[model samples]
Target chain A: DVKVTQSSRYLVKRTGEKVFLECVQDMDHENMFWYRQDPGLGLRLIYFSYDVKMKEKGDIPEGYSVSREKKERFSLILESASTNQTSMYLCASSFHSLNQPQHFGDGTRLSIL
Target chain B: AQSVTQPDIHITVSEGASLELRCNYSYGATPYLFWYVQSPGQGLQLLLKYFSGDTLVQGIKGFEAEFKRSQSSFNLRKPSVHWSDAAEYFCAVDQAGTALIFGKGTTLSVSS
Candidate 1:
């Protein structure tokens, strides 16, 4: 079975602090995605990377950025964290094929004070 | 624009009852549809996906979904509701094979 691992299941940070959320997938999938899951808004894509060192902005990418230094690792960075940035973060990976489904990590619950 | 919509925000059902969750999408061509379930405090799990062929797709944990092209809808159904089935369900559509456009999600609550 494919496994997607998030470094932290729960994280707490103060406003203006820079935060980094890490995710790693056992499968060598070519596509990686970062999303924030809010109560009513559902899951809003933050960023996605199709290849190492290549990233694309999703629907909501204002205060966030991503880095894919290695094939198995993808990182989400919060330049300046704020209270509004606190949310559940999810990481997913999938094969590059058009019909492939994405595998997701357990998710990281971030709290910004 | 391509989009996915899950009409119900929340639904409650008694154990052993039948279940159905509605999903609708607006796209030009035949769309790639998917159903995902997220347990409390967990990430989203792929329940099922419809790429082509069979309109009715069976998913994990005794769940299934059917794609209706004429209605532009893909609704999830289950023969019996289980307590474990209580979770948030999301309907998504693939946008040109790059990213998925997800619906707002419907929270299912099961009562014993």
Candidate 2:
């Protein structure tokens, strides 16, 4: 079975602090994505990486950035954490095809104070 | 741009009852539709997808969805509801590439 693992299941951060959320997939998929999920708003894509060192901004990528240094790992970076950024973060991986389904990680619940 | 809509924000049903969750999408041409389920504090799981050929598609966990081109709706259905089936459901549409645009989501509650 394919497994996507996030570095932390839950995290707490103070305002203005930098945060890093790590995601690793064992499937060797070529595409990785980062999304923040909020109540009523659902999951909005923050960023996606199709290959190592390649990234693209999604709909709600204003306050977030991502890094893909290796084929199996993708990281989401919060330059400065804020209260509004507090939400559940999900990481997903999929094949390079357009119709392939993405497999997701367990998710990280981030709380900023 | 592609968009998705899930009109119902929440729905309640009893166990062993049939269930249906409505999902509609907006796109210019043939669209790729998908349905996903997310449990509390967990990532979303793909329930079913509709690409081409057959309009009706069966998915994991006894879930199925039918694609309607005229209405642009792909609604999920299940014959019997289980207590463990309670979760938030999302409808999504993929336009030009791999990016998926999702709806707000509908929370399903299963009553005893």
Candidate 3:
């Protein structure tokens, strides 16, 4: 079975603090994604990387940035955490194709105080 | 740009009852459609996807969705509702590449 592992399941950070959310996939997928899910807003893509060291901005990528140093690992970075950024963050990975389905991590619920 | 819409924000049904969740899409051409489920504090799981072929597609956990080209809708259905099936369901459209546009999602509640 394919597994997408997230570093943290829950996290709390203070305002103005830098935060990192890590995701690792064991399926050797070439595509990794970061998304923030909010109530009523649904899941909005923040960033996605098709290959190592390659990244693309998604619909809502203002306060967020991503790093993909390795094909199996992707990280989401919050330069300065704020209360408004508190939400559920999800990481997903998929084969490098348009028709492939993305496999997701369990998710990390981040709260910025 | 392709978009998805899950009209029902919430739905409630008793155990063993039939279930249906409506989803609509807006795209210039025939786009890839998908349905996913997310339990509380969990990531979304792919329930089913419609790329081509038969309009009706069966998925995991006894869930199925039918794509209606005329209505531009892909509605999920289940013959019998289970308590464990209560979760948030999202409809999504893939224009190209791996990026997916998702709907707000519909929360399903199952009661005894």
Candidate 4:
């Protein structure tokens, strides 16, 4: 089975702090994505990387950025964490195809104070 | 713009009852549709997907969804509901080679 692992399941940070959420996928998939899930907004994509060092903005990309330094690792960075940025973060990886489904991590629930 | 819509925000049904969740989409051409389930505090799980050919697709956990081109809808259905079936369901459409566009989601509640 494919496993997408998030570094932190639960995290707490103060406002204006720089937060880093890490994700690693064992399936060697070429596509990785970062999304923030809110109560009514469902899952809004923050950023997605089709390959290492390549990133593209999604529907909601403000105040957030991502890095794909290696094939297996993808990182989501919060430049300045705020109370509004606190939400459940999900990481997913796919096999670089349109028909392929994305495999998701357990998710990181971040809380900003 | 291409988008996905899940009409029901929440639905409650008794155990052993038939269940159906509605999903509609707006796009220029035939779209790739998918149904995902998220258990409490977990990430989304792929319940089923519709690419082409077959209109009715069977998925894991006794869940299935049908793609109707005329209605532009792909609704999820199950013959019987279980307690463990309570979860949030999301319908998504492919964004023409980019990431998927997901709906707001429907929270399913199963009663005794």
Q: A4-111, model 3: which lDDT tens digit per residue?
A: 999999999999999999999999999999999999999999999999999999999999989998899999999999999999999999898777888899999999
Tens-digit per-residue lDDT, B36-71, candidate 3: 999987888999999999999999999999999999
Clashing pairs in 1: none
- Best-to-worst order by DockQ is 1, 3, 4, 2
Per-candidate Cα RMSD to the true structure, in Å, reads: 0.7, 1.0, 0.9, 0.7
- lDDT (C-alpha) at residue B55 in model 2: 96
- CA displacement after TM-score superposition, residue A111 of candidate 4 (Å): 0.4
Name the docking class for model 3. high
| Predicted complex 4: CAPRI docking category | medium
Error of 3 at B34 (Å): 1.0
Best candidate (score: lDDT): 1
**Cand 1, B chain, TM:** 0.98
For model 2, residues B2-33, the per-residue Cα lDDT tens digits are: 78999999999999999999999999978988
Model 4 over residues A17-102: C-alpha lDDT tens digits? 99999999999999999999999899999999999999999889999988899999999999999999989999999888778888
Model 1: residues with Cα > 4 Å off, grouped in runs: none
Q: Model 3, residue B2: displacement in angstroms?
A: 1.3
| DockQ of candidate 4, scored on C-alphas against the true complex (2 decimals) | 0.78
Best by DockQ: 1
Once superposed on the true structure, which residue ranges of model 2 sit more than 4 Å away at CA?
none
Across A1-113, the per-residue lDDT of candidate 2 in tens digits comes to: 89999999999999999999999999989999999898899889999998999999998898888989999999999999999999999999989886788888989999999
lDDT of 4 by residue, B47-84 (tens): 99998999999999999999999999999999999999
How well does model 3 score by local distance difference test?
A: 0.93
Model 2 chain A: ten consecutive residues of lowest lDDT = A94-103
Which lDDT tens digits does candidate 1 get at residues B19-80?
99999999887799999999999999999999999999999899999999989999999999
A33, model 4: CA deviation in Å?
A: 0.4
